[model samples]
Target chain A: MTRILAVGRYSDVDAAALAAMGAQALPSAAALAALPAALRAEVHGVAFMGHESFGAAEMDLLPALRVIANFGVGYDNIDVGAATARKVLVTNTPEVLSDDVADLAVGMLIAQSRGFEAGIASVRSGDWQRRGPLPLARRVTGRRVGILGLGRIGREIADRLAGFRCQIHYCARTPRQTPGWTRHGDPLSLARAVDDLVVAVVGGEETRGLVSAEVIAALGPDGVLVNIARGSVVDEPALIAALEQGRLRGAALDVFWNEPAVDPRLAALPNLLPLPHVGSATVESRAAMGELQRRNLSAVLAGQAAVTPINAP
Target chain B: MTRILAVGRYSDVDAAALAAMGAQALPSAAALAALPAALRAEVHGVAFMGHESFGAAEMDLLPALRVIANFGVGYDNIDVGAATARKVLVTNTPEVLSDDVADLAVGMLIAQSRGFEAGIASVRSGDWQRRGPLPLARRVTGRRVGILGLGRIGREIADRLAGFRCQIHYCARTPRQTPGWTRHGDPLSLARAVDDLVVAVVGGEETRGLVSAEVIAALGPDGVLVNIARGSVVDEPALIAALEQGRLRGAALDVFWNEPAVDPRLAALPNLLPLPHVGSATVESRAAMGELQRRNLSAVLAGQAAVTPINAP
Candidate 1:
C-alpha cells in the first residue's frame, strides 16, 4: 500500500528517494484532492514542498494522515493550527538550510548596495566599454545592519555581516544570548537604528505585515531593505510605494507576496535586485532538506515521534 | 604656479579636491606628455588615476616631477621601477580600499555560485512567472576557498569568507600570522587544494600570468575562479579556453585583459560574471582613495615624506 504521498515539484534526487520509499507522487494538493475518497484514505503521511496552501480543508481529505513533513524550514503554508486540530504531526527541516539562506541574504544585501544588477547588465550590454563605470555604489562593509528577527537564519545572516565589520542590530520576541549585537524593542526601533534592514522573521498570521509603513518610514530613504523572509512579513503595497517614490534606497528580495508572479511595478524598479525564492534552493541544501523530510515522514508513520516536529499532535 | 597635475577620470568630489589644492587636471598620460615642457616642468607632483602606462619616456618629460601619487592600491599602471630610477617617489592608496575590494570579491563569489546573473535575468525577463525556479545553485557556505595571495586585500577576503564558514586555504610568498588558515607553497598547490580559487596577488611583470593554465587545470571542472586582482595576473587566453570547454565551472571577473574592450567570446560566456573593474569603485572608497592620493602629493611637494610611498627616492 502507498502510505506516503509526495506533493509538489521535486528534484530528480528527491523523486528517486521518494520512489525508493514507495511514496506516491502528485503534482499538487489540488491533484491529491481529485483522487477518489477511497484512494486518499490510504495516505498515512505526506512529504510536502512548495508554497501552496495546505489548510484544514486539505487535511480533512486525508482521514488517515498521521504526519505532514515539510521540505523546507519555513512552514507558514502548512497551517499548524489545522494540523494540531486534526491530530496530525507537523515537522519541518530546519538548521540544515540556515547557512544557504544566510549566504543568499548576505549576497542580496551586497548585490543591492553594490549595484550588481546594473553592473552585470552594463557588462553584458557592452555598456562598460562604451559608457565607462556605473555610478558609484554604496559601501557594504562597516555599515549598520538590522535583522528583523534574530532566529536561526537571522543569526546566521548577522554572523556573516559581522565579518564585513557591519554593526549588527536585531529584534526578536524572546531574546537569545547575542553578544556584541544590539537588540531592539521592536521592528520600528530596529529599522530606525540601522542603515539597512533584512527581514528574517517567520511567516504566517502573527508576522503578516510586521514590517509596516511605519517600519519602512523608520528605515528612511538611505536605508536598503533585504527580505529573505516571507513576503507576508512586509506590507508589499507600502514597500512598492516607498521604492517608487525613492523614499527607500533599494531592495533585494528573494521572496514576494505573490511569488512566481511578482508585481510588474516592483519588477520594473531599477534599484531592485530581485530573485526567485531561492534562499535554500541550493543543490546541497535541497538534498539535505529532502533527507530530513523523509526521515520525519518515516519516523512519524512508524508510530514514533517526528524527527523535528513543530506540533505534538 | 600650479605645482600638481591630476590625470584620469575622477569623481566630482575628487575633481573639487584637486582644484582646491591648485592642481591642474589633464585628461590622460598622453595629455601630460603633450603639455609644453615649460609648463610640464612646473609640475612637481602628478595625482594619477586610470590604467595608462607611465614609464621612463613620460617621466623624462616632467623634469620637476618629484612624486607620482597613484589614486588606487595597485600601482601596476605606473612604472614604479622607472620612478625609482628617476628619483621620483611613487605612492599608492593601499589600505583605504581593501574593504571595498574584499566586499566585491566576496559578492562576486556568492553571486556566481548562487547564479545571481541567471537569477536576476529570470526575474527581469518574467521567466519565473513563465517557467519556474532556476536549477538549484551550488551552496557557498562551508566550501573550500583558496586565496592566491595573502596580502592586505587577500586577508580581508579570507576574513569575510571565514564568516561564511568556508575552509580557508592560501598561498603567500611571505607567510603572516594566519592561525587557522592552511597555507600552500604556491598557486598550483593552492588551486589543487581548494574548490574555489580567488586571485588576489599583486599585478606586474613578476606576478603576471600567475594563475597560469596549469593552475586553472588543477582547480578542475567544479572549481570557480574569482579575479579581483588584475587582468594581467590571469592568463586570459587559457581562461577563455577552459571556460569554453567546461574545463572549469565558472569565473567571476572584475578586471580583464585589455579591459574596457573585453573579448566578445569571454563576455558572451553564460558561466562568466563580468564587471568593469569595480573592486574599489564605491563612492566612499573612491573619496578616501582620492584623499589619500592628494595627501601623498601634498606631502611630497612640501618637501616631506610621502604618506604611503611604494618607491622612496
Candidate 2:
C-alpha cells in the first residue's frame, strides 16, 4: 500500500484514482492535524501548494516520503536545493495555468486603469449627472509596454497584448531573445522606455526588492504600474508613496508586500486596485493543476522520472 | 466669429484647440436653443457626441451648419441620414478607444470567470478560509468563445484572446472572413458551440435584444456570459432566471439592462459580476478622444471633410 500526504488544502482529492491504484492516504499533520494518527501515519508522499519544500527540520517526519507534487506553476515555495540535497523529488504544474494567470494580470490591469469599481459606484450612487457615460480613457494601443521579468507569464502577457498593437519591451537576466519583443537589461531601463511597467518577475532572495525606488521613479508620473508577481519583488513603501503623491498615475496589484495580510495604507489607496493574489485562481485551471500534481505524484510512486522536476536545478 | 455647437457634457473640453481655431464654443442647451439665430448670423458647425442627428425639425436652427463633428466613435447617436440630407458633413473618432474598450471586455470576462469580487469580499469579510488559493475558479483559456457582433471591438477582443489559445467563433449579420477567427452565421448557432458568450455587438434598433432566451438557454449551465456591448442586446429577465437557477455558470456585464437602475435582483446576485458601463474608460484614452473630437470639430469649422463621416451611411 502506497502512502500519500497532502500538505495543502485542495478542493477535492481524486479519491477514485488513488483508490483504483490501491494507495493508502496519509495526509500531513499540518494538513490533517485534526485526523487520528492512524490516518496520518500511512503517508508516503506529500502534495502541497506550489510544490512547497519541506525544510530539513520537518523532513524527519516523512522518512518514507519520496515525492512532493505542487499545485501551481510557480514552485519557488519549494526549496529545490534543499529537497535535492535530501534526495527528495519535487514536481509542479505549469503551462496549464499560464493563460489563467495571464488573464488575471490583464483583468487587474483594466480594473486598475479604468477604475471599474469607481464607475460602478458613480451609477450606484444614483446621481443622475454621474451616470453620463463610460469615460474614454487613453488606450493601451500603441503604447510602450515593459515587462519587468520576462519569464513564462511575462511572455504570455506579451502575446495577449499583441493584438492591442502595443510595443513590447522586457527585462531579463540573460538578455535573451523573443519574437516581437524588445529586450532590456534592467528594470529601470525598461521603465524609462514604457508608459506601463508590469512586474511579472519571480520572488525570493535574488528578486526581493528588485523593483526599487529608482526603477519606479524612472517610470515617472504619466505611467501605470502592475504587479502579478510575488509580493517581495517590489519596494512596497516606494510604490505606496508614489501612488499617494500622485507621482504614479495608477497601479494594479494582486500580490502584496505580505501574504494574506496587506498594508492598510495600500488598502486605503483609491488609485490602487488591490486583489487577493489570484493569478491562477480559476476553477478549471486549479482542478487541472491539482490533477497534474496527482499525475506527477503517481508517476513518482510508479518509479518513473517525475515530470516538471523542481529538484533538477 | 465662427460658432461651434458643443453637445454632450464633457468634463475636460479642449479649450486650447477651440481657442486656437478661433471658434466660439456654445454649451449643448444654449446652442440648441439659440441655433436658429446663430445660423442666420455666423455659426460654422456642430461639435457633438459621436452622433447627434439634427432632424428636419432642427434644420431651421443651423442653415449655416456645414459640418457635424462627432465627439467620440460610434456615430449611431447622430441622425446621419438627416445630416447627409442637409449636406452637413459628419465625422467620428476611430481607432482611438479600441484597446481600452477591448481591455474592459477582457476584464469583465476574467472578473466573472474568476469570481473576482466574490474573492475580494471573502477576504474583506475576514473569511479567508473560504477562499481558494493560487488556483482559482473557471478559467479563461480553452473556452469556446462565441462573440456576438463582430465589429472592430470584437475583432480586437479576438486578437487579445489569441494568446490564450481559445477557440474563437463569432456571429454577425453578414459573414466576415477575418483572419484567425471562425465566423458563425447566427447568435444561436454560435452560442450552441461555446462555453462562453461575449456580447461585443453594437447597440441601437438593429441589435437591441439580440441575445434572446433561446440563445441563453443554449449557452447552458456551464457557460459564462460577458457583455461589454449595449445592455439592450440581452434579455434581462431571462438572464436573471438563468443565473438564479444555475442554468448559466456566470455572467459579467458592464452595461446594465437599464442605466443607473440595475435590476436590484441582479445587483444582489452571487453569480454575477456587475459593473457600470466602463467601456473605453481610461484617462489617456479619454484625452485622446477629446483631442480627436476637437480636431474633427475644427475640420468641420474650417469647411473641410471630416475624417470619419457618420452621415455617409
Candidate 3:
C-alpha cells in the first residue's frame, strides 16, 4: 500500500528521490484518476507539481488524503480553501525560488531595453556589415523602475535593479519600511512615475486584472512592461491591443493567461518578447524547490505539521 | 573651406549637431578620398567614426590634418602611434561608453545562461504549448565570474556582478588594489577559477587572441564565455570549435574577428548567441560619445588642447 503519491513528470533526479522515499509516481492527474479506487484510497500524502487544476472532485477521489505539498511557490491551481474545509493541509515551496525569479525579471528588462531581438537578427541576416550599424538601443541604467506588489520576489527584483542605479518605485496596499524606495498608492501612479513597470504581485482572484488599461496607458509609448508574476495580474487583452497599436513601447513576459498557448497575435508583434513561463526554472532553484516540497511531505507523512503550510487546519 | 570634416554616417541628431558647428560631412573614407585636392587640403580636424582602417595612407591624403577625434572609445582603427609620430594629435571618446558596454556584457551573460534563444524561438515558432517545457537553464547568481581584463569596462562588469552575489575573479597586468575580488595571474588561471569568462581587454597587437584555446579549455564544458571587447581579443576559430563540440557550454559574443561578416559556421551553431558589435551602441552613450568627439575637434581647431587626447603631439 502506497502512503505517498508523487504527481507530475519530474526530472530524473527528483523522480529517483521520490522513489527512494517509497512513494508511487504518476505522470499526471489523468494517470492518478485511472488508478483503481483501492490504490487511490491508500494515498495519504501527495507531492504535487505542474499547473494543472486540482479541485474538490479530485480531492474527493482521494478520501484518505491528508496533505498536498506543492512543488512551486504558487498554489493557484490547487483549491486551498476546499483543502482547508476538508481538514487537508496544504504547503508550497517559496523563498527558495525567489532569487532565481528576480534574476530573470531583471535580465528580461535589460534585454528588451537593449534590443537583443534586432541585434541578434542583424548578425544572423548579414545586415550588420551590409546595412551599417543597427539603430541605437535605449539605455537601461539610471531609469525609473516601478514594481507592482513589493512582496518577497518584488523586493528581490528591486534590490537587483538598485545595482544598476535605477530609481526604484513600487505599489502595494501598505508601505513597507524600505529605505530610499518610493511607494505609490496605486498601480497607475506607479506606472506614471517609472520608465519601466515590472509586475511581481501574487496570482488568483484578488490580483486578477490589477494592472488595468489605464496603468498600461500611463506607462506611455517610451515605457516598458515586464511581468514575472502570473499573467492574470495584467489585462492581457488590453496589453495585446496596446502592443499591436504601438501605444506601449515594449513588453517582456514570462507568463500569460492561457500559457503553453500564447496568442499568435501577441507572438507576432516585434515589441513583445515572449518567454514560456521560465521563472524559477534554473537547476539550482528547481532542486531547492524539490527539496523543500519533499521536506513538507516528509513532515506531514510522519504525523506532524507541514513546514511551509499555506492553510490553517 | 571645410575646416572640420564629419566622417562616416551619423544619426540625425549627431549630424544636426555637426552641421550646427558649421562642419562639412562626408559619408565614408572613400567619399572623402574622392574629394578634390583643394577640398582635402582644407580639412584640418576630422570627427572620425566607423571601423574602417584610417592609417598613414589616409593621413597622407589630408596633409593639413591637425587632429583625428574618434567618436568611439577604441582608437585601434586610427593608428594612434602613427598620429603621434606625424605630430598629428589623436583623441578618443572614452569613459562615456563604458557604462553601456558593461550593461550589455551583464545582459548577455544572463540571456545566454537562461536559454533565451530557445525561449524566444518557441514563441515565434508557435511551439511553446506543443513543446511542454524548455530544458532547465543554469543559474546566474552565486556563480564564479572571471573577467579576462579588469580595465574600466571589466571593473564595471565586476561591480554589477557583485550585486548578483557572484564571486569575481580577474586577470590583468600587475594587480590593482581591488578588495574582495580574486586576482588571477593569467587568462588560463582566471578561466580555471570561474564558471564564466567575459573579455574586456583593449584591442591591438599586444592583446590580440588573448583568450586562446588553452584559456577556453580551462573554462571547461560547464563554463560560459561573454565578449564585449573587440573581436581580435578572442580566437574565433578555437571558440567556434569549442562551442560546436560542446567542449564549452556556450558563448555570447557582441564582437567578431571579421564583423559585419560573421563566419557562417559560427552563425549556424545553436549554442552561440551572436550579436552584432553593439558594445557602446545606445542612444545615451552614443550621444555622449558624439558630444565628446565634437568637443575634441572644436578645441583643436581653436588651437586649444583636446580634452581626451590619446596621443602626444
lDDT of 1 by residue, A1-313 (tens): 7488989988999999998999888989988779889989989999899999999999999999989999999999999999999999999999999999999999998888998878877887899989888899999999999999999999999999999999999999886897778999899989889999999999999999999999999988899999999999999999999999999999999999998899998889987889999999898999899999999999888878788999977
lDDT of 1 by residue, B1-313 (tens): 7488888888888999998999888989898767888898898888899998999989999987899999999988888888988899999999999999999999999999999989988988899999998999999999999999999999999999999999999999877888589999989999989999999999998899999999999999999999999999999999999999999999999999898889998889999999888899888999899989999998888888888999766
Ranked candidates, highest lDDT first = 1, 3, 2
How accurate locally is residue A163 in candidate 3, as Cα lDDT from 0 to 100? 81
| Fnat for the candidates in order | 0.81, 0.57, 0.77
Question: In DockQ, how does model 2 score against the reference complex?
Answer: 0.52
* CA lDDT, candidate 3, residue B98: 87
State every prediction's TM-score relative to the real structure. 0.99, 0.88, 0.97
User: Per-residue alpha-carbon lDDT of model 2 for A57-161, expressed as tens digits?
Assistant: 455456556787777776666666777776788888888777877777777766666666666555545542344665544466677889888888888887776
- TM-score, candidate 3, is 0.97
- Candidate 1 clashes between residue pairs 3 or more apart in a chain or in different chains: none
lDDT of 3 by residue, B1-313 (tens): 5488889889999999998888788888777678889978988888998888888888888889999999988877788877877789999998988888988999999999998878988877878888678889988988999988888899888888888888999999979778679998989889999999999988888889989999999999999999999999899999999998999999999989988889988888888888998888898999999899999988988889899998888
**Residue B65, model 1: Cα distance from true site in angstroms:** 1.0
For every candidate, C-alpha RMSD to the true structure in Å? 1.0, 3.5, 1.5
After superposition of all CA atoms, the RMSD between model 2 and the true structure is: 3.5
| Candidate number of the best TM-score | 1
- Give stretches of model 1 more than 4 Å off: none
Best by DockQ: 1
Model 2 in CAPRI terms: which quality? medium
Higher-DockQ candidate among 1 and 3? Answer: 1
Error at B69, model 2, angstroms: 2.0
